[model samples]
Target: MAEKSGKAFDFRLFKRLISYTQPYRFTFYFVAFAAIMLSIFGVLRPYLLQQVIDKTIIPKDGGLLVYFISLMVGVLFLEVISQFLFIYFANWLGQQVILDLRIKLFRHMLGFKKQYYDKSAVGRLVTRAVSDIETIASIFSQGLFMIISDLLKMLVILGYMFYQSWQLTLLVLVILPLIVYATRVFQKKMKAAFEEVRTQVSNLNSFVQERITGMKIVQLFTREETEYTNFKEINEKHKKGWIKTVWYNSIFFPIAEMSSSVTIGLIVWFGGLKAAQGDVITLGVVVAFIELSQMLFRPLRQIADKFNTLQMGMVAANRVFAVLDTEAIIENKGAINLEKVRGDIDFDDVRFSYLEGEEVLKGISLSVKAGETVAIVGATGAGKSTIINLLSRFYEIDSGTISIDKTDIKTVSLPSLRSHIAVVLQDVFLFADTILNNITLNNPEITEEQVQAAAKEIGIHDFIMSLPEGYHYNVKERGVMLSSGQRQLISFLRAYVTNPGILVLDEATSSIDSHSEQLIQDATDKITKGRTSIVIAHRLATIKNADKIIVMDQGTIVEQGNHNELLKISDGYYRNLYEVQFAEV
Candidate 1:
């Protein structure tokens, strides 16, 4: 149910939230001072009005009336100034804190291992970084200081009211307990409603993000009506969650308003009776008490609302902190810093699993000497690409070791290690940027001339220049402006410009047409010269000339040798695989 109970206040969460404001302590202190000043000014005007009624207007002392009126206006002016400072600085402090927090969250996410992201939704993380942090900012701007100021003002008003007429003040206290009970109930209900609202918001964001990213598939499969129905269901849930909050507000505010109205009536009745009965209560006392009652009740009413804001902000903080608290970051405990690598690779009895008890790569061992071109081929689910994944340390092996140049990769700093390796995947990803930026990825060290030279060598320079803007052409998101082959060609240029020691092509030629396959094949042959390369290809013919071929089945190596030697094994795994392709062609 959307009405599930939750804590209206969490002390530890609040303390952690306050720590983010440590850098802006001066602004924090200034805001505190402004709150105090606003509270003092709030009560002073009502008290001054009492004086104006009693000492000047009542006795018709015109000279004294002018003086009191001037005093009241001056107090009002200071009150406005103090109110401005409090509001301005509080919001300023909130924005600054959220800015720092958003940056910190994003930086932490960048360090997380791929495993962390495997089961996480990009949209939920986006909500945590963007909207959730924005809610947290309200804690400073409208929740804490505003609540404090209201409380202080109410206390001062109560003190002054008791001093003037203990009898009338005692009568006003009669309505207090009922209002307090109502406020407590309202606050609890609202907290739960707000929590439900936040949850639905995250779900809505996730659904929209996933749908948009997969819009191509949705259109291709003609699932528009089905997906639209799904979106409406989600949107309806979000609307219902928000309506729960509205329902609670509708019930609570009117109750608060009625209590305030009833209290004012009580004061008027009791104070008027006392004055008529020859008591100390006078007209000025009655009038001032009326104003004081409002000062007292309005804030009490607002306190409930502001407390809800505080609770909602705290809920958001808890969500944001949950992501910040994730310990899924890759362990980079290596002390060795390899500036350059020899590209000699070894995997000794390496074992791994994405899920427990479901091993994907089992007791696999392989070696590639420096400057050697090795190809791995297998049917789907045969752990072909898993080898490249493990080699790149994108996923840690459950057992055994992976080494590069005779040094354990675990003993090398991640940046220093990855710098010497380049990977080109079957599905190439290009940012929404110009071709030059996509190729160089904005690396200042690689010049335009260098990219042009590498493209010419790979035989894609003319193709790139034939585009509308040539190298400066925008590829749009995910390279939608280019064909599958063109994006792959750009990926090759991207990898080659790095001057990497090792190259990994994971089915890079799988989906392209024959023409593009030829171009990529030629590019691959050229770049593989004098460099250690690992090629995983669906087309056995493409890797026929590779120095060595490792054929895998069910996560284990079934056959491995040079292409000619593998062909000689009748009915062998590689032989059958090669024969099927040859017959298909």
Candidate 2:
């Protein structure tokens, strides 16, 4: 399990969760009414039994006995109907609330900056959305409702007991303090057990997800025995948590049962003596007292059980709230619209570091004209990709000014700024969707003809058309159904469909075959003709034709000029890179 930060659970999350039920207010109200009615019926049952013994059975009245028996049957029928209605409404409400919260959380996660994903694992997020939400739903639909109804019934039972005979009621009430103390102690133990269980469950989930995702790596390394042993260790930890919870629960139930038994046994002894001593109390009254004694503890037992469930729910809620409380690093508040951009971009003394004192881009200053192709070439970890990320505003600079057409990017809305730029990454990600939908990405306003045009322009249309389903071919998850080159071609087409003012190709053709690479280069040249372009390339041949080539080494520009100008330099980075590529060719 991930280490908890020890932050208090955000109460505001509860308020937000309750707000989801606003749409189903009428249904929830009806469910609550049913639960109340059911509790009232539960309390009335013992009184009816008392009356049956006193009025009908003792007096030997057959008609009255028949009527009382019929009444009991009617009450049972009503109870069943009410139970069904309550269950239906509560389950519906719980499902709706879960759906609503998951949607909101997912949308919020989507808007979060890349940094959040860089630090958080996918397995943890999935657990929050799925298992945690279900746990909270169980709390609301069953645990919370049962607790409220049982408490109400207990109060009514106590009031009636006191009304019947204060002496007997006083003796019973003496055990109340003990019950309360035991409950408090049990609650603390249960909560600790639940927290451990929740942690173990999360760890188990993480292990399963990791094993599935890295199955190939595991198999290739021949670590099946080691992996199985690791899994067993984690599984045992989860089992231990469950075992601790069960142990506490097992001890609690017997103690509660024993306490109730002792109380009832004493009540019978005292009541029996009073009846035999010729007191006003009759046999029927004593029988009713015994029934009421059992009734009183039944709800108390339910309350105990509910408390255990509530503890589990609260632990799950804490985890869910952790995810919901994480404020996105990037947010857009104002409406700063850019109608038509000339694509002039400038980076003024940009300095950035992922962590403090570890600069990635060191006071880098550069500019690109409205329609120039600028290629940035560098070795691994030399900040080539960081420049593109800064321009795209994926990460905010620690101290710098990035502007588009003389307007500071920070002043404009993030979505508005990014909407005008399109990026083609080296590791292309295509959704498990139809080819046309993957290309257009469900942009309803984008026409089929436009999609076809983009695919053709990227030189992937012929390949797509030759498929069994043509444009409608389904690309499996992560484009696993397609070859690496095919997936890259589709990604290129996707960017081309956007036709943004600025294009960023970050080693876009690095993973493709030579034939596909040539085709993509042609398509890239055509697309970048009149747009501001930033090309980060390892293969020098791809960027040799750029209007400007900036060579970087160790977060600073080593040289900057056109291809031939850099090649003429005595011992420049660009010249050295070009020599290596040509020598290999």
Using TM-score as the measure, the top candidate is: 1
TM-scores vs. true structure, each candidate:
0.97, 0.94
The TM-score that candidate 1 achieves is 0.97
lDDT of 2 by residue, 1-585 (tens): 222433223345455556778999998788788878887887677777877987998899989999989998999899889888888888788888878878877887888778788888778788888898788887667776777778877887788888888878877777767777776677778778888998888888888898987888999999899999999999999999999989987887787888788878877888778878877665666777777777777778777778777667667777876777787567566366787778999989999998789998899999999999999998999999988887777887899899999888888888788889999999988888988998889998788899998777767789999997988999878788899888888888888898899999999989999988988998998999999999988998888789999989989988999999999999877888888889998
User: Alpha carbon lDDT of residue 574, candidate 2?
Assistant: 81
Per-model CA lDDT versus the true structure: 0.90, 0.83
lDDT tens digits by residue: candidate 1, 185-289: 888888888888899999999999999999999999999999999999999999999899889889988987898899889988988898789788987788888
